[model samples]
Target: MTETPSREHRPEPLWAQAAELISEQITRDGLTPGSRLPTERDLCARFGISRVTLRKALGHLLDRGLVTSSHGRGWFVATPSTVREWPNDLESFTTTARRKGLVARSEVLEQLVRPATLDEADALAVPAGTPLLVLERVRFLGDVRMALDHAVLPAALAPGLADVDFTAASLFEELTARGVVLDRSETAIESRIAGEALAAKLHLSAGEPILLLDQTIYDADNRPILLSTVEYSGDRYRLRTTFRPR
Candidate 1:
């Protein structure tokens, strides 16, 4: 006798099935942004799934940036915002920004080879006075100008990058296309007033508050690939995180 495949052999989870159904509904109904979703009980009954399974599916939508839940209210479809959050296994800035429905645009202000300053050498873990490739850019979210990113790459690595259009794409993304393996990143964030040049790029008045992020992206072998500093305008940006104690 031939035996049927076990339930464990199913290709997708209950939540995944539920997520697809809800996703299809959203698409079919042409639900505009900020539209409220159905109740959990309604969803469970509609999909013929258990409450537990239905919730699992809702979780998938939340992870996909498609929906959000509230305490008093139920789930609602998300509207695009300038809020930036890091994704799990985030590999590129352009990819991350685009996922949030923001157009990732940049303008290269400076691209040249220069000797690393004492601080730059310390941050990059290279010899003092080592030559480094520097690319300065202003990053925009949609039509709103957001941040000025100053990126420094080691001279010991790809020296041919000076000719690339940094404004057209991200350096990290371009490096990956060249078969470079970037494993992880170290990021530090703080807030400060914008300098004169930064103010002009972000169209900010003097002494305005700004969020400053310093990021170091490393390769698979824990070698530092790029050092970057990003400055964010005050009114147009915010950062979110979920923390767990060690």
Candidate 2:
């Protein structure tokens, strides 16, 4: 009688297996930020994988923001402390920074009264030619510039808003003092790569990743009062929120 053939066990995908092995090695080695990873040749030899597979694993790490690559240098671990938790709240950037014991300040870049753009008009539910007060400011944490904020609102809704010293005060607080009661806000977050002007303003290299927050603030009466587009340096901030079961 012929003996039954033994079944073969398939292994995991090479790239995925390599990624897992590298991650384990990173943990076991206690590799700190800026620590250079083993050369690709060594890693390939150790993992019994090809160069392409090793690169795929490294690419996976890079996509997760766990590693970074220099032009001529190999991949290095990213700094964990560089990441900050940002909650999904309606608090002003100034207030959030202050709560964290960091000095927060703003530099007024542009302030003008102009006609609303088509997008702005739609967002504020105003006519295309409606007058709007636009304020652009750069936010700083201590000496490091962290974010750029562009805000627009109906000029008629906040009379004499142009007279306020926005660089020295919180826009939210100023609006509150002006009788604008903000009850809630809707926000959309996205990722983008910095362009020339934005890169210079944020002190980052061109094409660096950044976080964009487009939000609309509403009053207690559910009237939209303000539209803001804020860009934050990605390496310096992380969005975090808690989820609870209903």
Candidate 3:
């Protein structure tokens, strides 16, 4: 007697297939991270899917952390990967993440434009009472917490910097667009015991090891323009740099 065997391989949902193809297209086009993708209507037309199906596909990509949507700016590629090698030359965490093929996302912990105090002014070599933009964020690689970064710069340096969405914006890009020349950066790194407060934010236990990085960025004129501190979670990431002797 011949009995029909039940089908063992099931077809993927149309939306899931669409999502896969869209992700492939992102790589095939060599799209840069943070670059906007085609509009939803255009994507649907290209993929031969309806708007509803397209939305589902996009949602799937969003869930996979491959794309982000701006209020009116359409979808942006979030292509990035892990960070293990550190560039000896100056670099931004955002750039490092992209170069290392890891998605970099940030949770804005603080963003303020306020008058600089005497200490802040002295650190940045700016006049006291000058408007300074303060930014703090918990940087992440995919779902893993990586570092807590704090930065202060003259508010006028980037006119609308305070309004940028730090979660998706890169400070270096903003500074460059504003014609701010980053000539050099002086940096120092040390190991420290994480305090209860920092641990709470970084998901580490009190007294855990953390790498503290202090840096000051200077302009082409050799004037200090920005001061930054980044505390990297020791368990999650290690800092490395190449050394060469002439």
Candidate 4:
């Protein structure tokens, strides 16, 4: 007869196990946003773990953005918001919103034909002091202010653009109607904190998170037609892209 072989069982890491348990507890208890979690001591005892292990578990939750902590206050569930995906495409904000079955509107804050600044001239490949039409508008999704857009275009490319009714039509559509075909765009996005003026315009608290998009639009002949700086409410939007391996 062969001697029986012994088997050893390996357990999951204590902190990971604790994290899962706490996550389940949060769900089971129906904790909503801003709901305070139990004290550290209470969690430690309940999980039958030391303070270090409990803290590790909580750290995991914090890293996942599922919870947040205050200096004197305890941890609380994070507020969740609807995420709007912005794909890598040459699409206008109005078109994107319409596709989502949301109403989009614009409030033109300023529109004028002004001499191009050095940066604008460089981006548009035009000489400094060239007249450019600048359009600044506040965008709204239904009733909520969503973004602010500042677009600069060569006046020679789009004559009478400064007089166009931006509030009543899409900028891209207007340009297309005027025989300017936008073929592609190069864009960069970064996170930013809202300043007092911007926050007031967007109806958000000062220092709120926002997304800044800098784009240079080009025509089929690789001629830069427009440069835009768009600021979006961070909580109300998200950027997503799909990639395929070559």
As for candidate 4, its clashing pairs are: none
What would the TM-score be for candidate 2 when compared with the true structure? 0.67
Candidate 4 lDDT over residue span 140-212, tens digit each = 7766577899999998896777778888578987898889999999999999999989987876667878999
lDDT, each prediction: 0.74, 0.80, 0.80, 0.80
Q: Per-residue CA lDDT of candidate 1, range 25-138, in tens?
A: 898988855577988877776777778877787888877777766544677765444344555554566887777766688888999998999988888789988999998888
What lDDT tens digits, residue by residue, belong to model 3 across residues 1-246? 111111244377767777888888889998765567989877877777778988998888976767756444578775332354466777888887887777788999999999999999998888899999999999877775778999999998879999999997889878998999998999998999899899888766778788898999999999999999999865444556666898
Q: Which stretches of candidate 3 lie above 4 Å from their native place?
A: 1-82, 242-246
Cα deviation at 132, candidate 2, in Å, is: 0.6
CA lDDT of 243 in candidate 2? Answer: 90
Report the lDDT of model 1 for residue 56.
Answer: 80
- Give the lowest summed-lDDT range of ten residues in model 1: 1-10
On residues 179-210, what C-alpha lDDT tens digit does candidate 2 reach at each position?
Answer: 98989989999999989899888766778889
The TM-score values for the models, in the order shown, are 0.63, 0.67, 0.65, 0.67
